[model samples]
Target: MPTPIPPGSANETALLDLLRRHPRVLLTGPPGSGKTTLVHRVATRLADQGQACHCLAADPGLPGFGPPGAICLGRWDPRLDEGGGWRLETIEALATLDSARFRLPLVEAVRRLAARTEAGPLLIDAPGVERGIGGAELLAALVNASHAGAVVRLAPENAPDPYAQERVALGLEVLKLPAAPEARHPGHQLRTQRRTEAWDTYLTEAVEQSLDLVDLAIVGTPPPHDVTAAWHRRQAGLLDATGRTLAMGEVLALEGGRLKLLAPPLGDTPRTLVIRDAMRHSEGHLGTARPYRAPYPATPDEPSLRLPLQEAVDGPRPTLRLDGVRATLVNGVFGDPLLHLRLRHRKRSLLFDLGDPGRLPARLAHQVSDVFISHAHFDHIGGFLWLLRSRIGDYTPCRVYGPPGLAGHLDGLMRGILWDRVEEKAPRFEVFELHDERLAHYRLVAGQPMKALSPREVDDGVLHVEPGFRVRAVTLDHGTPVLAFAFEPDVEVKVRKERLDAHGWAPGPWLGELKQHVHAGVDETVIELPDGSQRTVAELAQHLLLSQPGKRLVYATDFGDTPDNRERLLRLARGAEVLFCEASFREDQAEQARRTGHLTARGCGEIAAAAAVGQLVPFHFSRRHVDDVGELYEEIRRHFPRLAATPGSDPYSEVD
Candidate 1:
């Protein structure tokens, strides 16, 4: 009589080889060794490899292991008894040493388990016996009678139970004494050995199942928090093939082998990175969050260490280079139809209302997004012909807003008699007429084409737009109905002193983001705090309401002797950093100025003083006293000393 061995053990493999047949396998192990799990793994591997195998778990709770007619039994819970058969138990179940009639259930359960198809090798997870139990003796009896050929033994992981060991020894002695029952079961055998190698197989499979790797490059992968850092590490070498790393979110200045990215650092890493040898351009980059594409090869033949030169500044965003933001005036006094305007942005330089009718300058040919008309008078829009003829490839469409009849006026201008001798295709013209009705604006493309827009007619209101600044329009009665525009940048500064103090913070790029958050509304703003927490824009605003201040600018022009109208203008212009007004006459001609509905030099100063503005600039003057402009200025200065001619002679001298 020997203890049955667990399958997958070295000793059992040798014993099975000696028996020349598959034996009824019983695997036993300590609590966490996964003996039951190992049985399923082996069965599944054999089935998947095309060897049909029947698996079963004889549980009292379940009639048998899961569904029928399958290569492997799915899953089973053994607690529910299906048959009214006698309960089966080994010596461990007989610790109370019940009457002989009670042993009927134990023998019945064992008989049923052994009766289950001896067609293939049976794998069983043996239960452990209680203290002082004779498990080996009972197993030996069942094996001798149940045709469990070539019995193999397994050892417990921990120290074996001394009581069970003694019972097994006693059983062996009783069976070897020749008084044993002549077991009718075929090929019956027994073995006992201290071999626990089967547990290793189960443990190995469990480890592999717990450790698995998966690819995360697919679409559903969650976005990483440190996107900036991730991009720099993963995309830097790939995108920056030129060996010249350019800051994607900032402008960089290159001078004398020094490189400087316009944006400052965030957290620890610089928000803008610069490569020393990067070949530079005047227009580095523009717009928000634009990806960078390297324009040079990594091994450019002549690699000079071209870098950005740095300049110390105090503002959040600084002007790194000058393009064409130049201003010139042709006539400041005397009603002359002459004017010039040049505005430059990061992308292009635009010149508007150029009075020169001959060959136009290259800057004047660039596309213009807007045209602010002083009036429909010939002098202000004299360059209309050159603008209509200078159209080139892919120019951003232009819109010119003017008084009521702007559409007809432009159509007539483009269809002027002088165009008969012209030899080139006419530039595309899109005119917008501003009427006094609710549907106040309408687009008139190339004269005949027309499209109506929502009625947004206001004598004085702000025109909101996306990327550009806001335009505040004021109607000035310059003979005819004239409108003047004031462009204000969208950036607004807001303070969060309490939050800053709480974190013991210093001023940096975080403040800029904070300001953006404030303007973008509560939902849009994300205020990252020093302690890794974030507060919305609304929260930040309410926290430090006193520290934040708002700024404004006002533009007023073409006022008659209407005191009420002038008063309103003065109020709007009050406390403004810059104020632009018209000085169309001298103080001596008050009656004439009153009749003409325009502001004289003295009148401009009066308004500036009354409004308490910081700076007063007078344009759109009458040519009646061009040479005596000094006299006009002297008259204005005599009353309001703060109103001065722009630095030198007059900045608006060309606005005649």
Candidate 2:
């Protein structure tokens, strides 16, 4: 550990002088380096000199001046100092431990605070993320967003500086200081203990209050808007319209459109309740609560078929599978149309549409790497902003594929936002626009306008190809041109476990290499065994490998029921394991479906049957038929007997 900078010493004086010269400063270091303590001392010294100083606690995990899972802004008043500190004046619970959820909002908050002319220097206490690629990107975004003139780093001697590249790139002044002598690293248990203490202190003057849920807008992790049921107790932060935290409370009960919460007495009515992690009070300590699981109810009209994708109301769940890939709907069948496919053995996921991405949890939303847009309707592309928000600080680029003019539409959306504070580390979007015979490419980055790249000629309507699968697209008419997509995987090659065991061979990277060679049609390569024996690829493949066709999934939506569209859809969806087609209206409302450039339930079924698909999963129903969606299902079953139930629509009574 490094020696402490003694109080009233020349080093301390120089640090104070450096802080005074910068209007905004970031106090950053690894955990246990005493960055929080240094912030307090600097604020106190500035206050002692009659200078008004503001402190922004930006670390949600171990906030020094606010409740846990929130960013706090407060002022230091020397007159009220009696060894105890002043409470946080304003709090914003943007997210818990995930910085991606709150990155953009946090930057806006800092810019607003720094713009205030009446306030003195702003001292920002940044989170302790001084290592790894994620940490470096996070810190760079913060430095750029806050527009901090200087960064005061506190670490032990001989510690490598993580922000050396950023400091030079941004032209920022660096101040190195020694860690506090009393600094001690906090474990997870200790961190939780401290957070509970902060919560307890925040509710010292709290009381129980009941308010009408209809009168207040719910933010963050809100319950289903249409469902009416008792939810498990959860922690929440009350805020007024101006984004100021009114009180921190626990949701005691929710019934009859009324919400009961225990929090400090409010002088004004709160307009919004920002839900935090599920929590409950045990004895006197705040602890984690079991997750809330809703009961599944069968549709009143049909006993065997469950509701239309009830799981979408709660969150995404794997309702169906195409081989090893799990599929989910971002919103229910009656809601927006968005299909999420969790790829097999991959950390990343794919999106068929961008509808209501807020329906996904923060963790899963960040895993989205590829987006396929059928059309540019608000219901299809409106969630692009939320997707961008969840991926702002991540290093992976999000690739988007859509119909013609998609690049222009997405570029217009990106240009609408003010990106002055965004840095080079922010999220990047690669948009691919599918034309008649070629795909146009465009690149978009925060703080810069979209740039067009050279177009690539489409080969057999194939849009994207990877190691195991390829994505192909075809244009359909939906008043406007809409692109229907097919996800086709290459032939699967599985090793025969019995043969491997008989040969005394164990699974290893060699098997993967063998599979790859087989996939590439290589037959002459030699394969070495663990026993120092070698065999030709042809001989080894014949003895060990079994080849089978990979499962295929097709996504078609928002297209008119016409001969041209039907032919195109059939060609793309033929022999697919599952076809997610849109049945927007029932047969009784065929005129309405035709006018809206959508397919009736009967038309959707005919197409599925013509394509000879294994299963037909219908979605994107017209809201006008929400009350009688069972009829639509029956209509589809009439033409295609292999209709499948919606995801999470199994007859199970309770959620696991």
Candidate 2 colliding pairs: 206-264
Q: What C-alpha lDDT does candidate 1 achieve relative to the native structure?
A: 0.40
Candidate 2's residue-wise lDDT over 613-641, tens digit each?
Answer: 99888888887765566788889988998
Q: Report the Cα lDDT for candidate 2.
A: 0.74
Each candidate structure's count of clashing pairs: 27, 1
Candidate 1 wrong stretches, greater than 4 Å: 1-345, 348-360, 365-367, 417-426, 436-439, 447-454, 457-460, 492-559, 647-656
On lDDT, the leading prediction is: 2
The sequence of per-residue lDDT tens digits that candidate 1 reaches over residues 315-423 is 0001111122333333322333233333332223323233443422433455355665646666667777666656533455566766667666776765554543433
| Deviation from native of the Cα of residue 423 in model 2, angstroms | 1.4
Error of 2 at 454 (Å): 1.0
